[model samples]
Target: MKYLSLLLFLVSITIAGQNDAIAKDYYNKGEFEKALHEYKKLYAQSSSNINYINQIVSTYQQLEQYDEAETFLLNILERINYPAFFVELGYNFQLKNEPEKANTYYNKALASIDVNPNHVFGIARLFQSHSLLEEAITAYNKAKALKPDFNFNLQMAQIYGEQGDLEKMFTSYIEFAVSSPIALNNVKRAINDFITEDSTNDNNIILRKILLKKLQEDPNLLWNKLLSWLFIQQKDFKKAFAQEKAIFNRESESLSGLEELALIALNDGQEDIALEIFTYLINTAQDIDTQLSAHHNILLLRTKLSNKEDFPNIKAQYNKIFEQYGKLPQTLDLQISYAHFLAFYDDKPEAAAQVLDHALDLPLNALQEAKVKLELGDILLLQEKFNKALIYFSQIQRNLKNSTISQEARFKVAKASYYKGDFKWAESQLNILKSSTSQLIANDALELKLLISDNKYEDSTQTALKLYAKADLLAFQNKKEESIIWLDKILKGHKTEPIVAQALYKQGQLFEEQSHYEGAITNYELIITNYRDGILVDDALFHLANIYIKQFNEPEKAKALLEQIIFNHADSIYFVDARKQYRALRGDAIK
Candidate 1:
């Protein structure tokens, strides 16, 4: 008997749900008369069902049966005393051009809110649905007054923003963030819609004043963190560093945030501030790993930012660090970086090879030895010792089979082969790396493979391709002027060849790397103009956009280029980055 009852109950629910779905389908198909007929039947079966009643009323309104909608709303209001029904009746009458009756019902809805604080939400939602911003604000304020812990600040902030009350919007967002800590990121996102990197902008000044005032009134750590975030948004790393320090000291947390800030500063070209942050961490960080990382980054920053004349001093500092830390696994990255600095910048590949060879003698794990070998192989390849480089790279591949480092070693081998004019071997290695676990390596392998295969058949002797590869190797070796010279040879001699686009793109990259924006722009624009459908078109567009935005401060031109990538090259590897940059340049809020 119980099983029969359960089956019957489910059958009844199924019938009712099917009836509801049929009515919805009718409404969606614009067969409102049929929908009304179905909903009226359902309402008769369940007279107390509010959903059925609301759907019937909405269907009436959809069919422009405003009088019927008003009648049903009035009847429901008499039965339930729901404040939202009054607003619905008012809207129905307004739709029927009965302004006086609409006003009366609207006033009743507002008056009904005072009878029950919880009804304020329904009244506010009704007002918001009708775009009555001021009325909705009053209703929400009433509810908050009735319930002190009520959190409508985020909603109010959105409304205030829509109403152009930016100060109030800012205040409301901050209040919401204070009440709900997890919503801090949301608040920052909302602020990003209006804020920009210009420190002298009005919005920035207003935000700064508000933050300063809050800090003076209440010394909360959230304010400090937010101020730090604001400074970062403005690209004011020095001020951001000060605020992050305040947050760290107040909270006594780990140095993770400070470390991240330093990296951000470094990436943003704030070398001095990043150096200061790293110096502070090296002296104050409790963990040895953090100290070592800071030391490594400091050297990296010096190598990137310091003048060539300071190479000897930087070398002496590296020696001092190696002497203090000794040759251990913990300091291996710094040691490797020092080797790279010596080889690439100081033109001391022999010395760089010697350092790595000594580091390789330490008691190291497989990965560590692989890393050292990779660097050694690179230096060897740089010195044109392709056979020696191949040996080291092959050792890593044998030791760490099926690993990311193995794939990296294979890529180096292919690169070395390509540089040695052994196209057949290089093409074989590159084909295997097309499915590499690392997307970057896979893309690189595919690109190099395409370059070799595409240009190999263009010329019988492959002189242009060989020249381009030598130029690429020179660029890799930091011999920029020499690389340009080699590239110029191809550009002048092989004007009609497909290699011209490749050479132009490479020259553009070298110029961009050297901060020669106009030169880079000229080459990139040539690729865009002359080789619009070529493989490097998107690359040229993206680099040109980056140069315009970051160096030339011409966001409009940058936006145009990014748009080209976004619309013209959806399948391009730069598609995602281009879209993000396009939105950011257009001042969209970034989360």
Candidate 2:
């Protein structure tokens, strides 16, 4: 009997929910009479439900029965003690063109806030819902003044923002964050909407002045954190690093913020500031892992800035770090990184393989072992030991099934096959990886797949495709001049083939990497003039524009190219970046 009753109750709840949805749909569709009929039935069963009551009152108003809404609201106020009813009454009066009576009831709602400050929420939300923003602000401020403990800063900040008072909004958000530290990120996210990437932007300046003034008034680490975040957003990494250092000095704890700031600086191409921050971390961080991370990053930055002559020095630095940290499980990531540097830059795959094999002998977790094996596979792939590389990559997939690294390993498997001229197997692997969990791997896989798929049918021999793959492999081996030479071979032999554009784009990229700007520009221009409809046109345009803007001081040409990207290549991955750069170049007013 009890089970049967429970089933009946569940059915009743489902029906009630369905009825409410139907009533809302009808109201939205302008069938207010039907909505009112459904809402009346619901209100008869649960008259205290605020949603049903509001719908009923709104239905009456939609029917132009203002008197009925007023009577219903007044009766509810007499029985229910809900302060929001005063707002409903006021709105109904306003609808009847009775501004004086509306003001009276609005004041009554404010008076209820005076009676109990906790009543401010319902009363203010109701007023705000009716677009009575000033009344809503008054209710919140009255409650705040009446009860000192009440935290209405968030609400008042939102209302102030709605009113276009950015100064007050910034002040309120800061105050709320200072009082409740847990809400700092939420407050920053809200503040972010009003600012711009240009530090000189008026809105950005407003936020900066507010943060600086707060810092002067109170030497709080919170202000420094906010200032750091703001400067990072503006791409002023040096200033952000200074602010981060100040926060660390005052707190004397928490390396998380500092580490993240370094990564942001690195990703933004502020190599100098990233190096400075990482150096500071290496010197000051007490935790072994943090210290090791800083050491690893410093190595990477140094290598990026190094050339063939400086490779020996980089090797010495790697040795210095390994000597200090010891070749153990704790230093596994740095070891793997070291192995990669040896193979890719120093052109010593044998030595790199030896280092990884030694590291593999250590006691390591599955993920760590997989990481080491992934690097080993990369080294083998770089050396063109395709079968050996496949063995390691396949090991990762079987050991760490469905993991991101496993996906990466799968992609590497496809790449190895491509390098070996096994296009059929490569395409098969790439098709599965089209939906990879790692977006970078998936993008690479798709690009490679498309390259093979499009050109394989053009020639039975695939001679041009083989030549292109060989040149791409040379480029991966960091032999840019040789890769450029190989790409030239393809251009000479297959000028009329579809692979010519790809070869041109690849050679352009190699020239750009070598800072051979004239050569790069020549290649990109050929693509622009001859292959504008190809997949790499936007890429060629963007890189060419960057060189003109940064290297040639030709802003007008850059702007024209960026315009093409905005209007022509809307679906390009670089569209958003291009639009932003274009807007900045055009001197559009900061948002």
In terms of lDDT, the best-performing candidate is: 2
Across 299-406, the per-residue lDDT of candidate 2 in tens digits comes to 888887788899889899889988888999999988998888899998888999999999989999999999999999888878889899999999999999999999
TM-score of each: 0.84, 0.88
Which tens-of-lDDT digit does each residue in 122-222 have in candidate 1?
A: 78787777777887898788778877888899989888887878788889999999999998998999987877776776777778888999999999988
The alpha-carbon deviation from the true structure for residue 550 of candidate 2, after best TM-score superposition, in angstroms, is 5.1
Summed over model 2, clashes come to: 0
Q: Point out the worst 10-residue segment of candidate 2 by lDDT.
A: 582-591
Worst 10-residue lDDT window, candidate 1: 582-591
Best by TM-score: 2
